[model samples]
Target: MSTPVGGDETQAPQSRFAGITAALRYPDIRTLFISTFANQFGQGTSHVIIGWLVLDMTGSALLVGAAFAVRSAPNLIVGLAAGPITDRYDRRILMKIAVIGLMLTALTLSGLVYFDVITISILLCGVFFLGAFQAMYMTARQAYVYDIVGANRAISGLALIGLAQRISQLIGALLAGTTILHIGGSGPFLAMAIGYLIGLTCIFMLVEVGDSAPDRQETIVENLINYFKALRSNRLLLSLMISTAGAEILGFSHAVILPILALQVLDVGPEGLGLLTASRFVGATVGIAGLAIAGDVKRPGALLLTTMFFFGISQIVLGYAQTFWVAVTLVAIVNIMATMSDVLHQSLLQLSVSNEQRGRAMGSWIIGIGTAPIGQSEVGLLAGATDSKTALLINGASLAILALIMAALLPKLRKL
Candidate 1:
């Protein structure tokens, strides 16, 4: 793979080139990458389709926010348990089971929609199940990456997955919107279900590649206790987890306000909303590509802080934009910043932790990422009372404040 300019010999691979090369180099990574790309493409499309469905159903921003909240609520409730469960099973098996569960759930959802029995309540209920399965699946998947590539190559592997997901999102969003416009919401739901099935098939064909040792014999309670004990001893990990949680809280919370911003502030429609969302993927793709080329830049902490600062500023810009095009541009910038921050945070967390506890650690890491809907609920309430733009401005300012505090407290992060 050719390296990017200014990158070390090992680090110089162009993000796009490197991702493909890395995937090709490792069979296990390639399988996981391909499966996840398919899953995310469907998922990205489903997100837009579902959100549009809810909005069309109720025309209430709160309901849309509630839909997102329902999706995330399971993570807050069940996320902590996922880590202990993942540690006790073969991650590959766990992922397969999770994917199956998701497929079934999607099938159930499609049945309702196909019968014309779907309602907001039904959708929300289905979303809850999907979210629960997703939490477990994500925990297992993150851990599995480490098993496939080892820690040294983990960041590269993650970048590749991110790249795949971004590209999928870009394609999926446009595809979903167009599909829904012509075929109704059922089309997207069925497509997503099929995608999950494909992902499951891919996993079945995969040959597990690292750490095939039988799991240590331990009671569930024993594993839970050990995980807590480990967490207690790792202050850096704890701090990193907290910082990660805070960032996600700030970021995902915007989902509640964004619909309102589109409908009221920017006066845009579903197409505009799709465009705005796609712009984020575009920015993310660029950011991921940049990072792949940069390859392990020093001072990840500083990069994190700077990226977050940009994220906050971009949100504020998004809130203030008067036209649809401007909103799309601001969202793109925010996505770029967010993509870099996400990569930096993941790399930092992976590098900071020990191998034995990686699954548990990453499970904890996602607890923060997954709990954003709770914060979004609060933002939704505020938006309900005030204007969407004001709510966004407030959230943006809060993120800026948190980023500044994090930067000051974690000097090491500043260097990165």
Candidate 2:
């Protein structure tokens, strides 16, 4: 069979382009790329604003974590149903509605903030709705990339998409911090609303026909059963999902406590928090771009494991960082490894699964990611009990230890 980028056997040699720019050859993929950047930009902005806003309101680490938890908790609720819906419907249509929902949610939040009437309850409700839309939008987006590019180039396609997301995040984080400093919390929400609207415009421009028939026409319960059966049968996919959850729970969840680090530990204020967040994305963008330019990987599973090992070490050191610059350096290293691991995880899953089951497979992946709330909340609880640095040190050391064990045990997964 022909590859996603390579047209046919006759053109195989010519289609071996090393650059990620090759994915842009498809018009619809281009639109997807732009829309992804916009969505991530809004998220990047929210990442900064939400933590600071919560901290400002309750002055408690637990509440800050709870605020972010509420945002992602919806993924647990809607993640299972998202895949089946994506598989049964046109992903393009799903994306259109999802983006609209995100825009309205952001706008409503902005209005509440501007009027100075927003409460924790109201913010959590808005975040929950936003998370629900995001869950569906991202699942469809991942599957839609497969529709544009096939499995052979899935890694490269996802890497480039990650690159775009990181770049937008870099910009969004920096802008959000500056905006919040000058205009308060309302500014970031207004900016997020605008970003979602721009994302909707890009989605509207996508011309792909995204409808597809499922492999089986069973009832929803039957389909859910079959999905679990498939996961059980495919040990690689199951292992990958487990590893993803471990990484998220251990390493990536430190994002929620960064505001505390900025305020109490580093004493750099909101601007410093923004810089720290932007630094992470800058490193992520570099790692993803390097992977994209390298093209096809010979040992992606091994690469994922190796990167994760370093990620844990970075997290460990970040816990002990006493200076702002020191924390920034550690965050950069942590994100580079984190981004590589994520791309590898998604690529391997997409390559292993069939198109009909792609949405459900990714839904399972989302559910694993949803475990971030547990990790984040733990960090908050620990930080409140002790110190932010101590919380991070413990989290990081645990992650590294777990990653080592997973690598040693999952030889089958390592080979892929």
Candidate 3:
């Protein structure tokens, strides 16, 4: 039987996967892993494909940034609702709907491309809707992992799922590049749609995990009120949310300028851009694999801050990389720290809350990262005004400083 978060873990099934941890033994977790792989593949594919499309169309870094910013705009809208919605419904079905949304958007894009009627405005609108579904899927899947694995193995469950996500990102990015070259015409969007379709089927295969805990979540309005109240009371949660936002705003925003780097800096084409993108995911996969091998962590919060600091440091170095392979290596290093920061923040936040609040907490996490639009636009603008290298240098320094400041100011966060 699937164990709900906050359930008595000892009473759940004792079955274990022979080569893996207790978390993978649960069939639901395994199914979740498979679905997450497909889901993230579509996600990773869409981002690169769109960025390339924008660059190809306008040859403007600023416009590319705007398109990506539009893609992230849905996070702010859907993030708040995702919490209560996830808490209120069957997570599997919610995820299923989200995957279908992804498919529909991909199909729409393919059709638009095929007709040669794809404009910046039309593309931005489709990207916005596509991001909406991706945000929901991201939020629900984390809560789903916590529910099935419980607190004891939350790290393992999430890390394993992260592995799937990272691996798929690597493949998706590489394939997106190849497809853009080989298939040419509506191939990228069609590939994204197919990935989402496969992912949706995997979601249906998940054993239904219902949250029937005695203290069911209250109404949406009540949950919002409670969220604010909890934010006030839980300093660590507040710190986490802010820090998560800071990471996205400063560190992750560098992704917005990647097209510039590929064309102007790295002197590469779309296929080469794919290699650059995959380099980061390769780093993420390796970092997560290390974490998974380490098993349960004793100080995820402290480690998270450390990763954030290094994340900044790596970006600073990345700004100076002139050679293509050198650039790839630095990008990978940056994401190794980036993915570690992500996994730690997520696991720490999930462990901090009771099962009743888990979904909302994940939603809050989504909202935190939803701050990406501000960064995407900022970095893009900065690249437009200055060079890509200068923008990365400035943003990287700010992120490192932010990490150190948080470490000093938030004692409770470090202790966690």
Candidate 4:
């Protein structure tokens, strides 16, 4: 069960939970956690607002897909760059700067809306900018966590963050729908801007941790080349990335399709969409809670593979659902599996990688996570051509097949 990160054998379990609880109590972790929670809540709210705004303005599925593409394309382009930058700078400062950038972007978008000058192109550009900052901020934040809780307790720390994020999404999605109905799109943007500012302030107030030593001094190009070399050399890491990427492609590909599913397949309105979204968040919250309470389980690797299998099956069930409630339940189950898989995969990554290579390893991890949007766009195009349900079914079946293939090919993945 133990892989020798830090604590002694007799007290490892108690120490792990104690570290997690202490980290939660620390001003640094508390401020960081709260700031992240607020930011994530705003992110969930913006997801609904942006899609609705795009669809309302253009009334075209293609434009909505484009908007989603704009939001995610930065991950494909700048995700690698983010890791080096995160390692080079003080992460707390980097986080504060990113939050400021986000706040400004949100305020700018809101101003455009207020002036009735916001175009689809402008909105897309704003989304791209927002996503770029988010990528940088997340890279820095993930790296910073080791400073707060030490590498030994990173998984438990991550689990707590996941729990907070899920709760935020569960509340934020429903609130966004109602806020949009009552106060309009501009209202959500204003709220998002305020959230970013609040997060920034919280970040500023936290006790500063001195920077970790830079991973290695290489030119940006050399750093990138070294990263690829590392990735290529580590077959276990590469396989894990590939497995996760496949699952993400299948699961996240349906994000845009969900609204379509609500309207077309379920014949329920935006309320149904909100409920379905909330149900997934609820499930994730439950899964995170379970992980938190389990302390330190040894089977994260096998657990990840099993979770992916169930996640794929849930997607298939969701694709075949004939009613709103049924689809909601299926999506919730899917979220539960997906959440568990994510936590386990991340834990494995943190446990297995060397400290010096953490930034690049995490960057590579982001690359895999980021590429799912490409699949999302592909799914959107397919759904536009055919039915959303059909697209979901095809992607889900593909995921299940990929999971089985991975299990056969990489036996090490079954043990963490």
Top lDDT hit? 3
Please report, in order, the local distance difference test score of every candidate based on alpha carbons: 0.73, 0.81, 0.82, 0.73
* lDDT over C-alpha atoms for residue 58 of model 3: 93
TM-score of every model? 0.90, 0.94, 0.94, 0.90
lDDT, residue 303, candidate 1: 79
Comparing 2 and 3 on lDDT, the stronger one: 3
Per-residue C-alpha lDDT of model 2 across residues 1-416, encoded as one tens digit per residue: 11233333123324344546566665677777888898778888988988888888888889887877778787765768877777667778988899899999999999999999999889889888888898888888877776666666677777877788889989999999999999989999898888888889998888756332244435566667777898889888788788878888888888877899998788899999999988889889988988887767988888888888888888888888879998898888889988898888777777777777877777777777777788878888888999887887888888888878988999977887
Give the CA lDDT, 0 to 100, for residue 315 in model 2.
83
List candidate 3 stretches off by more than 4 Å.
3-20, 210-215
Residue 61 in model 1: lDDT: 75
Badly placed stretches (over 4 Å) of model 1 are 1-20, 211-219
**Model 1 residue-pair collision total:** 12
Alpha carbon lDDT at 393, candidate 4: 80
Query: What's the distance in Å from true for residue 189, model 3?
Result: 0.9
What's the distance in Å from true for residue 63, model 3? 1.3
Query: How many pairs of residues collide in each model?
Result: 12, 0, 0, 0
